[model samples]
Target chain A: MNAVIFNGPRKIDVEKRPKPTLRDPTDAIVKVTSAGICGSELHMYRGHQKTATGHIMGHEFVGFIEEVGSDVRSFQVGQKVVCTFSPVCMCCWFCEHGYSNRCPEGLAPFGTQGLAGGQAEYVRVPFADGTLKSTPEGVDDELLIMMCDIFPTGHYGAMRAIECFRSSDLVNGNHYTDLDSPKRSGLSKSQSLEEAVFVCLGCGPVGLCAILTARSKGVRTIYVVDSVDDRLDQAAKLGGIPLKLGRDDVQAKVMKATQGRGADAVIEVVGNNAALRSAFDLLRPCGVLSSIGFHQGDLPFTALECYQKNLNINLGRAPVRTVFDEAMEVVAANKEKLASMVTHRLPLSKAAYGYEIFEKQLARKVILVP
Target chain B: MNAVIFNGPRKIDVEKRPKPTLRDPTDAIVKVTSAGICGSELHMYRGHQKTATGHIMGHEFVGFIEEVGSDVRSFQVGQKVVCTFSPVCMCCWFCEHGYSNRCPEGLAPFGTQGLAGGQAEYVRVPFADGTLKSTPEGVDDELLIMMCDIFPTGHYGAMRAIECFRSSDLVNGNHYTDLDSPKRSGLSKSQSLEEAVFVCLGCGPVGLCAILTARSKGVRTIYVVDSVDDRLDQAAKLGGIPLKLGRDDVQAKVMKATQGRGADAVIEVVGNNAALRSAFDLLRPCGVLSSIGFHQGDLPFTALECYQKNLNINLGRAPVRTVFDEAMEVVAANKEKLASMVTHRLPLSKAAYGYEIFEKQLARKVILVP
Candidate 1:
């Protein structure tokens, strides 16, 4: 099997590696169908996070199960499936609570698992019964590929921001939102959910997904912030109002749009220091702030701003499996229109060029077929 | 009327201020019955917070309705009442949402309203109808003083922690939880809850109140942490297992008590960086970490640990109105014994001395009488 391996910083090579096999009883060997280059992969490529040499790098993949171990009962050979970045055993406490990504006995579904990735011809899925989910009959690799993580990550980020927004005592009376409250705006009957705007930082695919997610749920005004003009244009094409980052007074512009209320919810999808800080500055009193941006280093923040604003500061990984179904429904609803997001698609042999274009932010989402 | 005022750091002096008359049409003048010297007073006394010289220095008080402006209609003159520190207008956007504290048109009961402290002969309360609560027939100053903040802070902390604990997916079968579920040794369901230990960091009145509040809910194995031995001893007398800060390994102790599973919920009453960090450290995977502590400064936390441990981080100011009823209920249930938390009593004439003791963290609840 030919796999993309990370040798060191700024290094990538396509080399022949042994095809993966089902080593554990709960494991399933998946033949690569389609995979997408991820933002996290760039971290490894940049040496932000240490990745070992000769490691099979990708985790975002959709595939057909080519072989199943003896104990694998939920899947069979040749079944089409999508799995998340992390694999969890369904029996683990975390999995039972809908956090399949944090299963104690789970394995990282990438090169770290000592198995070749879907970037190759085959990959082994640990805890297949719990981690792998079959796509609906008509969903293709192009659509189902999102089930792996991106769509859910974006959806979870938006949902968490909504959670924080609903928590504003200024908006909902008190910050103690009943997890039992309807997942959207946990407003009591007395509290009205009238007009609100969401400002999404970063014009990546995830940010676009968030714009779609927020708009689908009734928000008419959506602001997308990004430095790159082309990316901003892409966001605009995807039904978002784009604003140039750093060049524009995003805080004042958003505040003006919200009638001096600031943004009702600020989602920082870009993990830069300025983006995180701006996320807080762009919020209204009791505004919701959530981020899915992965930062490599520490940044300064103010609890006073968080408290005086009476914010419900929530931080955690995106609950992928929890939001996967809703995300699929969303994509399915906007299928033909959102298809433009996949600007470039190439065979696995051209993976190197796909990654190069993505790094320069020249291509939005580069899908590689196997 | 004479009141304790903050002139400078450690320079508190009694000011012969003019008697407060009704300024707002909705205001009520209360003949201060009993005022409690609070830890928050230190925020002003040490110049940590902005305080006007000759300004009244207290927010915690129980009093009687001596007079009311023309628009006041809720209570009659001569009625005993407990004033809430955070006032709600009942009609404001935040008030309607149940966050009377952040009421857009509301005012803070003390320094916020540009008045002298409640540590005086009389205090004026604006938005009187919603801010002042009449004492239930026989409730004395000892009970009434609590409604101002600390008791409700504890109850809010307890309820918030409960909500976080229940919502967290840190169980054996949950993905993030089971990965590090403290039950490295197989423990049954009966053992887990039976061995549930609760830890309250900082045995200040607020911390003690949280210990009492959680205990009031029948939580087993309560541990109280404080740097002062006297406070810890008081906590022990209040039925808590006391652990001296820095002197004791609170996390290890709680883990041992729960058979290596950290406390089910760790309520942080002291908002200092050390206590806040310890509170996070003291929790087992899926543990609920709530801070009611008035963290005066910034406390940077490691996000990866919080995510990897699957911590449910909840930080907020006391939602006074939301849990006022529960606090009263909890207090009423254990009234006979819990009132012992009030450690000292001093007349309003000695308000300066009272502030001195409170600044030193020497008193639990020092009640001031006219």
Candidate 2:
């Protein structure tokens, strides 16, 4: 089986690796049809995150189940499915409590440790019943692939920001939409959602998805900040008000847009100190900052800064398995946008090119067909 | 009027200061009958917080409305009322949005800036209708005074933790209490609240109030951490499982008590990096950390730590005015316990002694009669 292997820093190689087989009864072998070269992968490609040599390099993929272990009751061979970035045990306290992202028994992001990833032609998916979700009928492979990771993550960040705001005293006098009822999901009786201003820092794939998610959830104004002009243009195409970093006065634009109140919510997808600082500065009192970035640095703001701003910070990896269904609904709702999100599609042999374009931020999203 | 003035570090003096008079159309001059030395005041007393010489030293008080300005329609002269620690302008965006604690127009804690402290014979309260709540007819001045800051602060910490938990997917399958309705505010349909474990760092006034508040809200097990045995004993008396820092293996105890799940929630009232570090180490994945402490230090945890733990942190000053009515109900329900909370009562002339005992953790709470 041919696979994209992590050789070293800024190194990639297409090599013939042994085909994966089910290690546990709950495991299944997924023949990867389509996989994404994520922005997170850039962290490893750029040597930001340590990666072992010969490790498979993708966590987002959509394909058919080539084989299923006897214990895998929910899926069968030939079933079309999407795999979550990390596998969950499904019965751990965190998994039972709907926080599968932190499942103590198993939350290893695929392609790391002993778990090989989906960039290969065949990959073993442990806890298949918990990790794999069937693609909705009629959805394209690329659109369903988006639901595998970044889309759900972006959706979760946006959803969490809105949820935090909805449960706050900020919405006390204002009529707001209830997310539980799909028929009445967005702004309805009140224009508060339309009036509420949001900010998304970074215009990467996940940030673009956050913008789309915010729009679908009835947020009328989203000030998207990014350094790259191409990414900012993509955000603007998705209806986000783009603020180019170091070029535009980001804080002034957000404050002006929000009537000097700052943003009601900020979805921070850029996992750096500067982005976190901007998030703190661009939020109003009692504002929610939902950070979905895979940050490695210490928090930029002091405890006093958080208190004075009365900040509510909800941050973590998206529980992809938990929010899969809802994210699919969002994906289904914005199928066209998701389709356009894929800027480049390449064969498994062209994985190096995919990595290069993605690392340079020249491509919005690159899909590799195996 | 005689008042407790901040002279210098560890130097408190009872001095004759001019009696405060109504200064604005919404101001009211209160004849302070009782004022309590709070944990927050100790910060300024110890010079941790900058305090000007001759600054009056208390923010918690129960008094009679001696005089009301023309715009103070809700508060009448001679009405018994409890004044919030900080006065909030009723018309600010934060005040209208339910975050009166961060009211940009007027969140200066009384005793700071131009606002005279309440530890005097008379104190002027701006936004009288917004800051003062009428005391329950039969409640003791001391118990109602508790509602001014610490009690509501503790209650807010507990409530915010519970609210954050309730609105999460953790309570999806489990039946939980609804906070809006007084009748259904605690555990009812399920025993999850009883099974849930909470941790409170620091067993001073606010931490003690947190224990009582958690118990009142049907949280059966709370591990209260403190270095002082006296404070731990007070927490034990209020149904908390006391954990003495340095004396006990705090992390081991919490892990054992929670089946290695850490704490379901952590109410951090100690305004230091150590307490914040303890909070991060003691919380389970997706646990809520409600910090009502006035911390000046940078956050102890890194963004990676927060992300890895999937933490939800709600930190700020308690909006005493916003939660005034609810806290009064908590106060009314636990009046007997609250009565025992005030371990020392001193005359205005003995303010120095009161500050000494309270600063040394010899007193659970100190009330000064003016």
Candidate 3:
């Protein structure tokens, strides 16, 4: 079987590998039909996050079950399914409560930590009954592959950004055109979902997914920020008002648009200190910073700053399996817009080029056919 | 008028000062009947948080409206009322949305930042209609005084601690005695509020109030941690299982109690790095750390740590005026248990002694009769 392997820093190779087989009664052997190169994968590809010299490299995949172990009751051979980045046990308390990412079974993302990636022709999926979701009818392989990781993650960020307001009575059809109080408009009111302003701090694939999810959920305006013009243009095409990070006074523009009150929520998908600082600066007094970024450093701001702003930070990995079905609905609703997100589709032999173009910001979404 | 004045670090004095007057049309002059020394005040009292010498030094008070400005429509002269720690504009977007603590008008807590303290013969309250609450019928001055800050703050902490679980479908009358996973009990399941385990990381006035609030809200067991034997005894008396810091293996005890799942929530009232570390260590996955402590330092953990634990940190000042009525109910339900929290009652002239004993941990709560 051919697979994309991580060779070292800025190194990826397409090489022949042994086919995977079910290791446990609950495992399934899946033949990969379509897989994606995630933005998170760039961290390992660039050696920012260490990966073994020769490890399989992909967590986003849609595959058909080639064989199922006897204990895999929910799935059968020849079933088309989407796989979550990490598998989880179905019975644990965390899993039962919709926090499957933190399942005591441990989060071992496919392609890392000795787990073979689905970029290969065949891959072993453990806990198949709990981790694999059937591809929804009418959803293409491109969209189903996204549901495995990025789409659900983006949807998760959007859900968390609005969860605080969703439960409030104030969320009921209240609209305010003017947010600036005693200074500008002399009238101020709380914003409902339609009236609330959001800022997406990156225009990467996940950021675009978040923008799409937010739009689908009734968010009217999203100010998307990024350094790359191409990504910002893509964001603009998705109905977001683009703001370049350095040239554009992003803070001033967002503040002016919001009538001096910052965004009600800032979805931070870029896992860096600068993006975090921007998110903090671009929030209203009681704003939510829903971050799905895989950060490696300490938070840029102090506890005192969070307190002064009355900030509510809801961050972590998306519980993919928990939100997988809901994310599929998001993808199904905006299939055409999401389909355009696929800028590159290549054979498994060109996986290294896919990684190269993705790292250089020339590709939005790249798919691999094994 | 006589008032408690901050002289410097560890220096407190009762001095004669000019009587306060209405500075704005929304102001009201309240004659202080009772004022309590709040745990947060110790920060400025001990010079951990610097304050100008001679500033009045208390924020928790219940008093009678001695005079009301023409614009103060909701309050009138001679009406008994409880004052929140900070003043907020009634008309701001934040105030209307239950985030009055971060009202765009600014958060000016009484007794700091040049605002006159309630520990005086008289005090002036700005935004009276929004900042002052009518004392509940049959509630004593002691309990109402606590409602000004400590009680509501404690209730806010408890509410945030259980909020994640409160909204969960898994909170529906489920009881699970064993949470140990594939390793130990092998019968892990989510515990409902009545069956969930909680740990309060302090037993000061606010911490004890949180324990009481958690109990009133159907939390069956709380393990309260404090080094002071006196505070621990008070916690035990309030139905909390006491764990002494440094003397007891707090983590071991909590893990044992929850069958290795740790606390469902950790109410962090102690504002320090050690307490934060302990809170992180004691929490189960997806646990809530409702921190109301006035922290001056950076967070003890990194973003990766927060992500790894799937931590949901709800930390900030409590929106006192927003939760005032609800906190009054908490006080009214647990009046006797709360009453015992006040260990020192002194006249206004003995303010120095109150500050001294409170800083030494010899006082659980102190109220001043002006």
- Evaluate model 1: give its lDDT: 0.70
Global local distance difference test of model 3: 0.81
Model 1 chain B weakest lDDT span, ten residues long: B179-188
Q: What TM-score do all the candidates reach, one by one?
A: 0.86, 0.93, 0.92
Tens digit of per-residue lDDT, candidate 1, span A32-149 = 8888888767767777777567787787899889999899998988888997777767675445546555556654556553545668778888878877888887777777776677
> Positional deviation of B296 in candidate 2, in angstroms?
0.7
Collision count of model 1: 22
Worst 10-residue lDDT window for candidate 2 chain A reads A182-191
Tens digit per residue, CA lDDT, model 1, B53-165: 65677888888899998888888899888888766666665555555556654445474326556878888887888788877766678877888899888777766665445
lDDT of 2 by residue, A1-370 (tens): 9999999888889999999887899899999999988888787898887756788989999999999999999987899999998888777677666777787646578877567888889999998998899888999877877887898898888878876765565222222123222122221122266778899999898998889988987788899999999888889988999899889999999888878989999999988788988898999888889999988878889888987877889878888777777678778877776677888989999999999988887888999999
Candidate 3 residue lDDT tens string, A81-148: 99998888776777776777787664788888568888889899988998888877888887887888
Tens digits of per-residue lDDT, candidate 3, B245-359, equal 8899999999999889888889989987789788989998777777888888888888888778767676688777776766777788788777777888899999999999999
Which has the better TM-score: candidate 1, or candidate 3? 3
